[model samples]
Target: MTMSEGDLAVTELAFVRREQIAPLPPPAMTTGPLAWVRDNLLSSILNVILTVVMTALAVWVIYEILDFLIFTAVWSGADREACLASPAQPVVGACWPFVKERAAYFVYGSYPIPERWRVDIFFAMLATGIVWLLWLNAPRRDIGAFYFFVIVPIVSYILLTGWPLIGLEAVDTALWGGVLVTIVVAWAGIVVSLPVGIVLALGRRSRMTTVRTLSVIFIEFVRGVPLITVLFMASVMLPLFVPDQWSPDKLLRALVGIALFASAYMAEVVRAGLAAIPKGQFEGAQAVGLGYWQMMRFIVLPQALKITIPNIVNTYIGLFKDTTLVFIVGIFDLLKTVEVSRIDPKWATPVTSTTGYAVAAIFYFVFCYGMSCYARATEARLARSERR
Candidate 1:
């Protein structure tokens, strides 16, 4: 409709703004760190009270821990007297001196001092392979995988146990102890478990009845029992069934048991990841003419494994700590060494056991926390890549 002459005359007298209004800044309460604090910690009166109480408690606990670990700790000297409270030092905290004295024993245990260099070499090789594999941008990652999953284990075996052909002395597994044994048990379990778990997970889902049945039986049987029982059976009962000459080393048995136990748990984690995948994924892969193995490997397994990284890492962390259980079989792991050291009459003091346990706690925390951090980083990286 055309504007009437009278309307036009009135519109001409009215003023109209010609430019867009500038946008206002976001509200002050919604845009800063203080906003986060307020929203999360002080959103309600009850939350405010809880936050203050928790913060104060945290600070107090931290202060107490630092005091026990550092402020009153004994740093040097020989024997129990060094850690004992005296007139000169009226209070004692951690017995750093005790840890200092037994540091070598804690690392090498009964492994011969001169031959301990072999263990050091193994550690270096293991670290090299791990860094090579885990460094996403590193060159020749396939070779890194080979180095980590294949060469390292073989060379490590020869290096740690010795080889006559290589002019190395044979060090019995009985002599393996301390951090050496602990890392060995954990590394073996971690390395073997994942691939075995994948196969078991696949078998559990297989169309073949016999394969599925066997997989289910193995997984259920292992999961039904405690790890300590597995350790005992492997370390003690297995030898009874095998020929005397065919019997495995005690450490070997425990390693097998640990690997089996972890694989069972890992299989369940993998299966959960697999179940989370939609049927469309399987159908789409087949629609593209992919074979069963190719579909699983390229189209399915990667997604499944990635989905379960957190659970996989959780199982690994538990297995790492579970290495301490080998002590029940007379294997001297890191904790076992600490246990042995605390009982030494020379260093016996009120604080000796506490200090030893504190060291063990720190060791476990550092490694487990490192694994957790790495897993989180991997998850974040994967999420970023997917978003792009």
Candidate 2:
């Protein structure tokens, strides 16, 4: 029964430590930016190839864009001659002079120069309302909401179209063109789409047979048709329903078409978000003695809308871009203005069309990208709040 000294020595060597060991630094290859690069960029041969190829492609694209936008772009001149390539001038990218000369036309699109101040005031008021409403923590948000939802549209009509009774001579909607027209169409679509879409979404889910059926019919009919069809019908066919003199403004008709089309798409986006919400949410709201409308207004709808923020913003961006389609019906939005100006004998050059389109592209990109970024930030903020 006696153990040998060699056996006791082996048992002593295998003893466990009682105290905790201090943590050691991770290996250099697995702990720093190098580690991140290793794991994400070069973890495999395929990944390494993809990373390298994509990086080079991005660099080339960026360089080409900069070269066209800045390096070779014409900065100033008096006429078309400024943009034309010469033996001395060599390469020319954008025709800045053309854009500069026709800047007013691009923005106002033959809106009476004498009355353009009204458009300016309209812009100022719109900017004010948008800033106030979008500032998140802005003071007097209720007032901002009132100004945006109520006062702006009403006042904008009277201010821009003019109230002759108030000494402001009537500036016909026919004179509305360019940025003014684009903004009008987009603003109407974005503002009108959300509330209308919410209604349609709720209707689709409602137990009432008539409301649900009507909502389904409308959403399907609108979604089933192209925006062009709606616009054409609005601008051309709708007038047939009324006497010639009583027909609505062409711009107004287009506005209605765009709003309706956008609302239909928005309804689907919202419905998807609503579907994602658990039935427990509805039950919980009801259990708290909240009426259907109150439960939706205070609980369900907010969560649904928040979840669908990206989709909603995406729809807004599409509607914004689709404003260009108004030109088919003789309504001159920003793109139409660009189309008209590019053919002018005074500023026309090889680059004129390219330049005009470039400006429109930049404008659309800025606005769309802004909306996207705002939506992303909103999503992040909501996520943080939920985590808290």
Candidate 3:
């Protein structure tokens, strides 16, 4: 259609001007604690109700625990009678006096009074070495690692068992029990299993048929059996394989069983991590002319191990807790020590058993929680490094 000449004439252009750009604040509803409450606790009607219920329940539980553990608990007493409720003291709580009285026995078991200092020294040195290794800013981390991985274990063993060549009186392994034995078994399993697991994992993925087959068989066989069965076999059946004149210490046998059992599980965890690495990583290493071990060491393993830190720590925690199973083999670990201590007629109160177990639980929790926290920190650090 054509526009008529009379319809409309020339038009003038219109323009609008801005004085300044304004900055806007974030929504008040999406900041601070109130925002967290809105997003997490009160996101929906059901969430609000659940959060309220859980919070109230947690508060009640915490209060009850504190009341039992502290408010009405007897801290000073000689025996069970003092821990019990009487006309003079109607309130009854945890028999902490029993724990305090037998603290040494719980720690060192029957490992003679005079030799206790050796255990103490060993703990001090171990703590020092750990502090040095984990200090972050501490000097000579390589030296600290060497001391921990090499010298500390040797010195610790010598100190704990005593070196007659060095004029120190020997302590019998039979006398070792309680937390001392538990730490030994757990630490040994943790330290020994990692390398064994790595080797098994590598073998499982090896190019050679025999190596792969043997690795698979061992891993499957061990993983198929319950830990208790392995422990029983180590304690009972292992002696038959050795010469009559060559008897292995029961503790050593238990350590072997625990280490082997842990290694199988650890190998699976490591294998998962190795599998997660892209094939390109391996190809890249090969393209750079790196040999198998060298490629794994400098390229593959560091990444794989970092990825597996959480699983590795979980394995360590499981091994630590399983040390309690040594009780079945007549080795007095922390749990066994507590059990034995609670049976004493002198301290046998209604609360003694619970108190003893609570103490052991606290010890286990602290160690496990520490490992978990360390794993989180390490993961975060590695993530940040990768981002950079």
Residue 166 in model 3: lDDT: 93
Instruction: Estimate TM-scores for all models.
Output: 0.93, 0.91, 0.92
lDDT of 1 by residue, 1-388 (tens): 9999999999999889899999998988897988899999999999999999999999999988999999988988888989999999998999998999899999999999989999999999999998998899999999999999999999999999999997999999999899999999999999999999999999999999999999999999999999999999998999999999999999999999999999999999999999999999999999999999999999899999999999999999999999999999899999999999999999999999999999999999999999999999999999999999
On lDDT, who's better, 1 or 2?
A: 1
**Which residue runs of candidate 3 sit more than 4 Å off their true CA positions?**
1-25
On a 0 to 1 TM-score scale, where does candidate 2 land against the true structure? Answer: 0.91
- Point to the candidate with the largest lDDT: 1
Candidate 3 C-alpha lDDT tens digits along 1-388: 8756554342233446667667887788889888998998999999989999999999999998888789988899888999988898787888899999989988999999988999999888888888898888999999999998899899999999899999889998999988899889988898899999999999999999999999999999999998989989999898898886786888988999999999999999999999999999999999999999999999999989998999999899888988988899889998998989899999878888988998999999999899889889988988999899
lDDT of each: 0.95, 0.92, 0.91
Point out the higher-scoring one by lDDT: 2 or 3: 2
Which sections of candidate 2 miss by over 4 Å? 1-36
Residue pairs with backbone overlap in model 2: none
lDDT of 2 by residue, 162-261 (tens): 8888899888788778888999899999999999999999999999999999999999999999999999999999999999999988888899999999
Per-structure clash totals for the candidates: 0, 0, 0
